[model samples]
Target chain A: MLAIRRTAPDPDGRLTGIEIADRPAPPRPDGWTTVRLKSASVNHSDLAAVRGPGFEPGTHRVLGIDGAGLDEDGNEVIVYPIVSGPGYADPLYDPDLRALSQGLDGTWAEEVHVPRANLIPKPAGLSWDHAACLGTAWLTAYRMLFGRADLKPGETVLVQGAGGGVSTALISLGVAAGLRVWVTSRDPDRGERAVTELGAHAAFSPGARLPEQVDAAMDATGRATFAHSLRSVRTGGRLVTAGAVTGGTTDLDLADLFIRSISLHGSAMGSPTDLRNLARHCATGGARPKIDSTWPLHDAKPGIARALAGDQFGKIVLHCA
Target chain B: MLAIRRTAPDPDGRLTGIEIADRPAPPRPDGWTTVRLKSASVNHSDLAAVRGPGFEPGTHRVLGIDGAGLDEDGNEVIVYPIVSGPGYADPLYDPDLRALSQGLDGTWAEEVHVPRANLIPKPAGLSWDHAACLGTAWLTAYRMLFGRADLKPGETVLVQGAGGGVSTALISLGVAAGLRVWVTSRDPDRGERAVTELGAHAAFSPGARLPEQVDAAMDATGRATFAHSLRSVRTGGRLVTAGAVTGGTTDLDLADLFIRSISLHGSAMGSPTDLRNLARHCATGGARPKIDSTWPLHDAKPGIARALAGDQFGKIVLHCA
Candidate 1:
């Protein structure tokens, strides 16, 4: 089976040992099972782990954070890309896994081993490529919108950044969840794309003030959009963050947060229960993950590169059929 | 009537020049009434107003953040220090008035005028000093503990920096409300005092490891105690903060917060309605504000100095008789 593995943390370039290579089939441990990958999605975490200080310093690291496949018994399933300790029941709080790709060998390969508890039955109508996108980014958006923020139907939500996986996921999922989803993008074209292709009610420039303050603001853009998210939300509203791809340090005005009674929820991927809930939500809402592009297992570099370049919306998946 | 006034900001020196000199009674605005102040409590906000940045460089600024007195028409009332606009009736989107204190005159001295809505009925059995203490710090603590954090009885709570007004309020009120209150302080004696006098379950050094984790943690000490507060809470617990008196910058590990699903609630002084609720809660529970000592109106300098030095446990009150 061919895998994308990094042998060293390259500073000036991408993952050092990037190549199509073969490895022995990994056996499943107790309470864990192997997913024969049919489709695996590429995420920015794959690119960051290759060059950034993600996991340990110098070892072969497998990259990919989400996948859809067949369980050992041949039932279709989505591998929620997290591998954790025996005590890792919540999945999100699992000590060994820092949201899928931080330390664990994630799910962008021919086959991947994951805790059985991380597997959710793929709905009959959902395709493998769509299921693959639900693992990290989409689940994160779902938890941010519904679980952490407790957003209500018809409530307005401001989504900072319109073309990334979570941002695009938020537009679609929020709309399907009955929220009036508005999106922000640095590029007007991307904003237009979000409104046209995704389910966003409207889209604007990064600091373009909305006509009305939203009930909640979903901000994965980090410092680049944090102030706008703070300003965009109505008083007593919430700001939820599941990712900080941009810079992290932002001017935090304590007085503003207090006066408005606004809450900031630092949300990561999600719990096992949330992952299951995400599957159910997407299935019941007839929502599918937006796939930017798909490639065969051997041609994973371009998909990873596109995700690293921040040039695409939705997920870039690698299918291994 | 006598009033304590700050003629200038003195960041490092004693808050002086404000005198209990004779003045005409304060004139009331529409929808406002004059309170003949029988007693006013010295909060750190008062000290901050007198000696810190809240004071204008060249204006005579009245100083006090909490008071109890007789409203016009002879009604015994406690002044809710914050005077909100009519917009506060629907607080969901309105900027809270408590945040407007930087520009508005604060409560202190002999007689003060406030909007009628900021008056809460003072129970006959409660002392003026106790009622005054509930005006700002106690109400802030009450909202954080019960209203915002949504704490349940018998749950464990850790209060960082045990001796301040809000921390002491949390300890006393948390105990009265059936929480297992644990507090942290640098001073061993204050910790011991907190355990013995305030009914805390246990006390530890600022960063001392606890025997067990708590359901919630209240942090006002900021940089000095934030990490420990983050560490002390159980998974899925709440970390509530009202002030950052010591300092605010800390190396915040965002990963830890998201993994544990910890929720951080930043609070300030609460609404007038919440102040009334706090007064009622104290009356029902027979709880009194822990007063370290009371100074006469003329001797308020020393009380202000003590509060500024951060040496007092519980509220330092300045009583005007």
Candidate 2:
């Protein structure tokens, strides 16, 4: 079996550390099962692992957080990445909760092992690539929009950073769920394409004043867009964040938060329940994960390069068949 | 009539700008009525107005945010301090929301005028001073505990800063509502007294690691206690803030927030509904606001001094009767 692994972390967040090489098949632990990988999607977390400080110092670790594959009985399955304690009904509440590629080998290989409970039967409506996309970026966006923000139909939502995996996921999912979705991008072309390709109701330049206040806003851009997200929400609105791609620290004006009655929610990759709901919605609603590009597993370096460049509009996937 | 007013804005927050003087009674507006004040409590907001920037410059503004008085009909009432646009059911959502003493003459005067809708009839069970405390500190505390945090019974709540008006209110309210209340204070005597007099489960020095994590935490001593509040809450718990007596700005670590799934809420002086609910609960539950010291309206300077010195254990009041 061949696996894509990071021999060392890249200081500049490039693909220099990523390599494809032959590796042994993953072992099936007592309560775990193995999945023959058919497809895996690249996420910002994968890029982040390649960047630095995520994995241990010297050990080579396979680097993927999301994938779809076939089980031993030939059943198609979508893998949930989080590994937690026994009988932990909600992994989000697990104190020692961790996901793949953080301290363990991940899914960018021919075969990968996961706890039996982490596998969800893949719906026939979704392609293997789209199911792979669900495990990381799509599930995170789903939780941020529906589970955390609790947005209602006909309400407006502003998504900061129009072109990442999470931003694109938020736009498509928000639109399908009956929300009026607006997006912001630093690049005009990306902003324009968000409206046309991703079903966003409108798009704006980054930090530009919105035409009217939105009921909620999703910020994955962190310090660069946090202030704007705070200012653009209507009174009593919510702002949900999953990642801070630009920077992690920001100034929070306590007076503005309480006087305006806004709620700030910090959301990470969601619960298994949230992933299940996301898959059902996508399967039934005919919503599909947008793919920027796909490459064969043995030739994944160029895909990693494109993801690091961040010019692509959606999830970059690797075909493992 | 005698009133305590801010003579001018002070660059430094001190009582030098506050004066007790005789002023003409305020005229009742078309839809408003006058309340002959029986008691008014000193809040950190009042201290801020005296100190600087919260109020207009060169205008002598009566400086009190919480009060109890007799309406024109001779019925005792608690005045809701917020004034909003016509037909506004929820003042928090109103764009033009303004509180007493921010621009208008507040409750420190012998008589103050307020919209008829802002008055909640006082129950005979509450003393005038206790009712007076409900408009600002108690209402803010009630909203922080019940409305914003949405804490359930048996959950533990950490009330940061034990000596202030809001902290005392939170302790009593949380305990009365069946929550396990823990408090933090820099003064050992204050922390000890909180356990004995306010029914707190335990008390700790500021920023001391708790024996156990709380389900929710309330921070009023901004900058000084913000990091502690964030660190002390359990995963997925809430932290609510109303006033920052020390300072307003704080560093928010986005990664910590999202990874832990914590929610941060900003609360101001609560709505008329919350005020009414708080008054009813205090009246029935036998929970009363602690009065640190009471002075005659004309002799309020020393009371302000004690409040500014931050050594008082509870609300400082002015008796106008």
Candidate 3:
């Protein structure tokens, strides 16, 4: 089996290897299912794990979290990225799952074994590439809007940083949910495209004041746009976040938070329940995942590089076939 | 009539004056009651009005939110400081009520007018001083624990600071409600007193690591202890804050928040219903306010000075007689 494994943490992304690897196949546990990968998407997480804090030198760590493939009976399914406690004993901070990723192998491989509950049936109408994209970014955006923020239809959502995977997903999902969406981008062209193509009402500079305050603000830009996002929400509104990219450290104005009565909800990945809800929402909305570009499995480096550089607007997929 | 009026925002307590002021006796409006104040308590708001923000320099502003006084016919009543729209709205972000003190004359005076609905029957066994504390600090603490955090009995609550009125009230309320309360104070003596007198199990320095993480935390110290309070909660825990004394700016660690599954909830004073519930709790538990010192209505300066200096352990009261 060929897999992407990190033999050492490398800032240059050169130490990560994509090669034929041999291992004893995982024996199926009573409640687990082994899925053969048909396709998998390259997320920033995949690129980060190669060089970031988790990987130790000389240790083989399997890398992918988002994948779509087939079960033993040939039934298509979407793999939800989060692998936490069997039940909801606090999904975000389960120590067991935290230790496993640093210890166990992840998805970027020929076959991945996951608990039976981690697999959700892929809708017949959705393609493998679309299902793969749904696993992480889409589910995250879905949870941010509906699950955490509870952003209702006809409300406004200001998404900071226009061209990343989660921001793109937020725009599409926000529009589909009848929310008036706005985006912020450093590039005017990208901002315009995000507005015109993604159904956003307008786009502006990262911290430029909005025409009017929004009901909720989706912030993943971290330290850069956090204060602006806090300012963008109407009094008693919310700011929901999933990732803090550029930097995770930020200054919070406690006065703004308390005086305006704002809520700051920090989201990790989607929970199992949130994944199920996102799938159902996608099924109803007739929404298809947006693919920035797809690559054959052998040519995975470019897709990973594109995602790593934050150049792609939508998911970068690696087609296994 | 005598009143404590702030002519300007002055942190030195110099802008506040106890003066002989003249006004028409409050006439009962529809659904309103005119209470000839028997006693009213001093709060940080009074000091802030004298020295904080949003007040015109020449305009006289009466500054207190809580009072226990006699209504017409000498009926003892506890003044409910919350004035809302026709029905109960969520207190967290009611825009109409946010500008309350700025919009209306407050309670630190000889006579205070309140809506008839805002008066709760004073419990016979409760002292006027204790009842006076309930309107502002005690009510706010109750909402922070039960309404905002939904903290159940036996859960651990870490109070960031212990000498302020709300902190003292929280200590009493948490103990009454069966929660193990821990408090933090910079002064060793205050910490000892918090444990020995106020039922706090232990007390630590503002940012000192606790023996164990708490299920929920209450913070009003703002920039001074926000980071520590955020770190002190266990995963899936809550941080509820109502006021910020030192300052309102603080650095936030977004990664820590998401990784720990912590939620930051901002609380304002509270609703009328919250005040009623708090009074009932006090009535049941026989909890009395921690009065630092009381002054005759003629000389409220000393108490006001103690409040301004943050020198009091609990509430500073002004007695009308």
Q: Tell me, what's the RMSD of every candidate?
A: 5.7, 4.5, 4.0
The stretch of ten residues in a row with the least summed lDDT in candidate 2 chain B is B49-58
Query: Tens-digit lDDT track for model 2 on B212-289?
Result: 878899988888999999999988789998878788888999988898888999887788889999999999998998
DockQ category of candidate 2? medium
TM-score head-to-head 2 vs 3, winner: 3
Q: Candidate 1 residues B141-257, lDDT tens each?
A: 898899778889988999997777788889988998998999988899989999988889998987888998788898877767777888988776788877777666555554456
TM-scores vs. true structure, each candidate: 0.74, 0.82, 0.85
Q: Model 1: clashing residue pairs?
A: none
Candidate DockQ values, in order, are: 0.25, 0.63, 0.51
Clashes of 3: 4
Q: List the residue pairs that clash in candidate 2.
A: A258-B266, A258-B267
Q: Tens-digit lDDT track for model 2 on A61-82?
A: 8889999999989999998999
lDDT agreement of model 3 with the native: 0.77
Which digits, one per residue and each the tens of the lDDT, describe model 3 over residues A32-114? Answer: 77888888887766776755676566666667778878988898887766667654455665645741234556666777778
- lDDT: worst 10-residue window of model 2 chain A: A86-95
Better of 1 and 3 by DockQ: 3
Whole-model lDDT values for every prediction: 0.76, 0.87, 0.77
Q: How many Å off is the CA of B157 in candidate 1?
A: 4.0
Cα lDDT tens digits for candidate 1, A18-119: 666788654556776788889988766677676576547565557788888899899998877665555533655544455445566667678877777777
